[model samples]
Target chain A: MAVSFSRRIRSLAPVLVLLALCLVIASTNSNFLSVSNLIRLLSAAAIPLVLVMGATFVILMGSIDLSVEGVVALAAVAASMLVANDFTSLDLGFVALPAAMLLGGLLGLANGLLHVRLAIPSFMTTLGIGFACVGVATAILGGFTVRISDRTFRELTLGRLFDVPYSVWVAGLCVLVAWIIQERTRIGRWVYAIGTDEHTARQVGVPVERTRILVFALAGVFYGLGGAMSASQLGQGHALLSQGRLFTTITAVVVGGTALSGGVGSVLNSVVGVLVVIVLANGMVLMGIEPFVQQGVQGLLIILAVSLALDRSRLAVVK
Target chain B: METFREYLPPVVLVLLVLAVGAIEPGFLAVDNLLTVTADTMTLFLMASGATFVIMMGGIDLSIQGVASMTSCIVAALLPELGFAAVPVALFAGAASGLLCGIVSTRLRIPSFIASLAISGIVTTVAYWASDTRSVLIAAGDRDSFLAWAVGDTGPLQNEILVGLVALLLLGLLLNGTPFGRYVRAIGSQERAVVASGIPVERVKILAFTLSGLMAGLAGVVMAGRLGSGSPTLANEFLLPAIACIIVGGTAITGGVGSIFRTFIGALTIAVVRIGMTFVGVSVFAQQIVFGLILVLAVAITMDRSKVTTVK
Candidate 1:
């Protein structure tokens, strides 16, 4: 396909953002150039990247996901119990990752079902679902921690391959898979079409309802996977995993230059969005800026980035 | 359709509470009910505030951050501020809400993203200000906070009274005032209102300002309840506050939800939360139930034709 200059810019967005972040980090600290830190950066970016990848598909379809964080906490706590450490060798929480994924998928599936089937607005569906999911997670743990002790899963998350962290590998594979699904599959085409125009897409024979449900379910898999891997890193399941999920995922998506208005973005956009967010956090850490201030600044930056990138032409009014 | 459906959510909530109480004998107790009501008030403040924003079809995500920040601020400012603490804490929260509104309306960023940004900024600022610790209300100020927090002028707790007062004031403003009508009109159709010569921008800005004011009040009440200001004190209230509004029958798409319904919504949330614990529902299951209820609430009460698409 011949790409327009604008389309090219949209595609190049992630690279541009990554390069810009690199230059800024390099300028702020010479030590940022070290391969060790670079890998660490990639790893740090990976978690949010997985999350943003999940969110981007929803955003591309012109909706949102606020439930990932809640699901993550539920999933992470589930993962924590499974690692076979202090809690129990025969852990259901460990199996809870798939359960969490199923739960998350069901939640997302609900979001899509309510969205297309019942016609509840996407914003409302996800918001309500996120709350419900978090409430359930808290109920399960009773606000306590579920620790993971499985050496194998921990190694899977922490272990390195060819000097690369496992997190990076997992995140990279996810991105690749996401890209393939977005570009090559029939489902992918339906997704793009729906985001562009739900009615027109439906008229053109896209299974809008089926595609949306699938996309939301797909997002659940990421949240669940992220939750599961998070156990490897922390060895505990805490419902806190999803605390700032809505803000962070949306921020990363916009930072990667994805339009909040839907129909125009890529998996690479998510990769870059997550990278930029992590870069900002990591750079702030390196600069010794207070963590709280860093959060506030990141929040402000997200608003700024999205405002700039929003395609107002496509939106008669933004809600 | 609107008239009958308007009462549906509250009725459902009443029935749900009755159901929960019937299942678990412990849920019907007064002392337990009072505490739950107190907890509900904190979110009620935020929901009442958010109702204004929602009526304008704009959502505010800063309720949690502002509440958390105000708790920290009140605790930190106690030595110098004294009884003046109430105004200052409320001011701080509202200011944060105002900033969010400015970011959304002036910059043309959507309220969802704008408020999300504000939540981030406020949470961070609160974290920094509190030095990542809860700030204790000084000894001299402790009595005053107690009076506000636990004092009983009569049957209701002080904080609960304040919430009721807020509810009355906000309800009147939402129903009886021109501002209220404009808000509803804005929610129904922004461009139409603008075309009709209403100052859509000002209405929006004011809606957010009102939201901020309510959050500020909530923060103060929350501080009183905790008896010490901690950033995390009101952090947990975020989901519940929004949930209360949604479950109270407010449209996530905006222009349709009401503060009156949200009042009942807050009560519903409180009852569900406190009742579930007493009913022997596990905490994790409670969280799941909260999420599930929100879906159910929105599913049943939401006006789908009003919004052309989700998100």
Candidate 2:
């Protein structure tokens, strides 16, 4: 018998996986699917969603962004400090957002420049930038949490539309921007082309190094936004709390059906992956599953997801 | 004169020690030096193990997870099973990494992703066993394995001696054995090796298994030092371990780095970390410095000829 192929089925796998997981989680507890709970999950996933989207571009180019956690922490700290708060005597008003963005962008810029100019691998450069950011954040804050009371920043996160939080809107805007950039721009095509074959792309006059730098810079921007959003929601910034997000972001992206090997992922996949992971975490927490067990399950899901999505054709041996 | 090439790395280490010592007199203290050296032993073992896998042009992200899982098993099983638990714990670690290697070889996932998946599975399973809480091996049950960490020596510590032993033995294996040659062939060009009739999967699996075993050794040592196991116990080790391997100048692209280089890298990282704390650098500044050093280390040591692209 001949099997019929369907494009819709090909794309629906991620959505179905997410929905099935959500259904199972929701069935375990009534509160799992409650608006408030889901709202929390979405917000939690949003920071990673933005970061992973940024990461996708780099990974698409066969590079990665491990500096996210550090950048996010730094940006979060900056946001916390600059906002009108009990702990902070300074308020840069709205300038705090861009100021935070600048700091994150500069670190990313350093990472990109090192890779392109100094010939360092993106892995090492990004790793260094991340640690540097963490060191800077810890030094500035003195290991203390900075609580933000800026009404404007708070309003952006705490405000809601049709009972959904402002964060969801911000996240939606980010996804839209990412999708547009990926779909319409020549740079987007370059991203895919470069992933498929960097040498050929360069031969055709694609600005490989510049595009690579821009992608990292873009990732830094997303990280900045994500970190600032985190500060707004928590009304406080803590360096240590933000350090645990890299493995989570990478796992979420992989689970959503993005290939870590590059050239085969979408922003949509990341969003759904974020939802799947965040929901699992939030639902498990709500279900009173031990944090340890939840962590284990998450690890299992990462392996399972990659096993399912990895394309065997490109690789001859796994190593 | 023939030995000058071999002696270069240690000479560098000595200079680094002197430079650090000149800046701060406290850097040479026995307690601080012993602790740093002890902490590095785990990574030393790991980097040595991975040096072989990397020499085959494959990477292992599963080291920390394997270590975590091994420690978790040791912590959970020690009192009930005594010394019998060590083999079981080690076997579990090796098996987890073996599964990852198998996934890469059979399922055709890249080693990086395959090892990542394995890390996920191992860490998750370990977490479930430990419940995020740190569990210590009962004092009565720890005498044998704790000996691997430290007992005593005339003037030096035994743990450092063990690290040297693991390195020397493995370095001999890599440089002397036919398996090492095959791994190098596979790493440098697998297609050519397969066409020549080498059993690629066998060598790949063996390398990963060795990597797992080394990580297990690290875990056992870590458990002895910390006197407990926790879900996130080996998490911090991942970066420093990789950083040390890279800093010792092992190419990440893998077919050319030596265990000797990795040993040096581990020691360098351990010294920097300890030195930072002693200098009273705040935790945040320490993070920033580690980050910068990771990049700088890679920049200094990475082999540009092997890595045409920075992936």
The parts of candidate 2 lying over 4 Å away from their true place are A1-8, A22-41, A85-88, A139-142, A149-152, A279-288, B1-7, B21-36, B137-145, B273-286
What is candidate 2's lDDT per residue for B28-90, written digit by digit as tens? 787767767866788887677777777787778789888988888888888878777788888
Model 2, A22-73: lDDT tens per residue? 8888787898867788778877776777777777788777777878888999
Question: lDDT score, residue B60, model 2?
Answer: 84
Which sections of candidate 1 miss by over 4 Å?
A: A1-14, A91-107, B9-39
Query: lDDT value for candidate 2?
Result: 0.77
Q: Against the native chain B, what TM-score does each candidate's chain B reach?
A: 0.93, 0.90
CAPRI class assigned to model 2: medium
Model 1 chain A, poorest ten-residue lDDT window? A88-97
DockQ of each candidate, alpha-carbon based: 0.64, 0.53
Q: Give the per-residue lDDT digits (tens) of candidate 1, residues B243-294.
A: 7888788876567877888999889887777667766787767766776677
